[model samples]
Target: MTASSSIGTGPGRALIAVYGLFSLAAGARATVQIAGRFQEAPLAYSLSAFAALVYIVLTVALWRGARGLALVALGIELAGVLVIGTASLLDPAAFPDETVWSAYGKGYLFIPLVLPVVGLYWLLRRRR
Candidate 1:
């Protein structure tokens, strides 16, 4: 892809950076939580690790200008946040500890909730 059409350029650079940051943050958080106290909240820790994996894939997709893959990953990310956020609120007992997507990423200032929307917008906008 040309530089002009590359998702890693211009505004997409910020998106990629945010995704990379989330990958690291979520991965590290999950590793620590899982290794230290998996029994405390297996679901929550596993979900955090899953979110980290999604972020890693999304970041790579954006960097490589793989719009289709990025779109799919973003959709999954958004759905995960929404579903997990609602589940955590409605049934707190299910999540003894918090995941990266807990409460729509409240701990991370809701960036997890909004990032995919912004990414979808950026990718779609770049297409035209």
Candidate 2:
């Protein structure tokens, strides 16, 4: 298959796998936080849930080779990481607990910060 047509094959498969994993991770974390201790940090748990939704959509978009949808999802993911990361750092009191995006995803080894950049590059590179 030509490289351009292989957006969901080869390396792109790995990207989709990562996105899928992140979706599950963030979703589970959010579920537990919201059910068990949401009173401790409602904003943090809600952001985790939002991040999970973005990752879910991104995984599907990448797997389906939907470039436009992937681009929009990646844009949202990157912006969330940046804004939430900064907010978490600037106002630690506001985030008594951590979200998937806290401290630029330090909890996830910075994958949340890096994934959108990589996904964007992958999608753009495959553009005609």
Candidate 3:
């Protein structure tokens, strides 16, 4: 078996890399936003922090081959991006600034929109 087969059977190294990118990006963004000017956009910054937490959890779960936790985190992340994406688009005023999911992650090149789909696919494939 390959190194990937030694873990859960899915996308393997590629998925880990993607998850790592998200973990780093989200964590850094949240850390800066929450630390710098949280008072300016409390809700948005808080949501950013939450998104970072989810990303971190998702990354670790995937790395450890915890398919169940990965699925749960990815599902929650998908729902969050969708709901917040729509809300941000429909009600710009509701958000004083941007969150991780704002505008469907337009600021993040829509990766927020795409990552969950990939994650779900990997998770389902591993389930079989």
Q: Model 1, range 58-104, lDDT digits (tens) per residue?
A: 99999888888999999999999999999999999999888999999
Q: Point out the worst 10-residue segment of candidate 3 by lDDT.
A: 1-10
- Model 3 TM: 0.89
Residue 36 miss distance in model 2 (angstroms): 0.6
Off by over 4 Å in 1: 1-5
lDDT of 3 at 36: 91
Instruction: Please count the clashing residue pairs in each candidate, in the order shown.
Output: 0, 0, 0
Highest TM-score: give the candidate number: 1
- Flag clash pairs in model 2: none
In the range 1-128, model 2's lDDT, one tens digit per residue, is: 65444778878999999999999999999999999999999999999999999999988988877777888999999999999999999999999999999999999999999999998888787775
Sort all candidates by TM-score, best to worst. 1, 2, 3
Backbone clashes in candidate 1 total 0
Q: Root-mean-square deviation of each candidate, in angstroms?
A: 1.4, 1.6, 2.5
The C-alpha TM-scores of every prediction are: 0.96, 0.94, 0.89
Model 2, residue 92: what's the lDDT? 98
Largest lDDT belongs to which candidate? 1
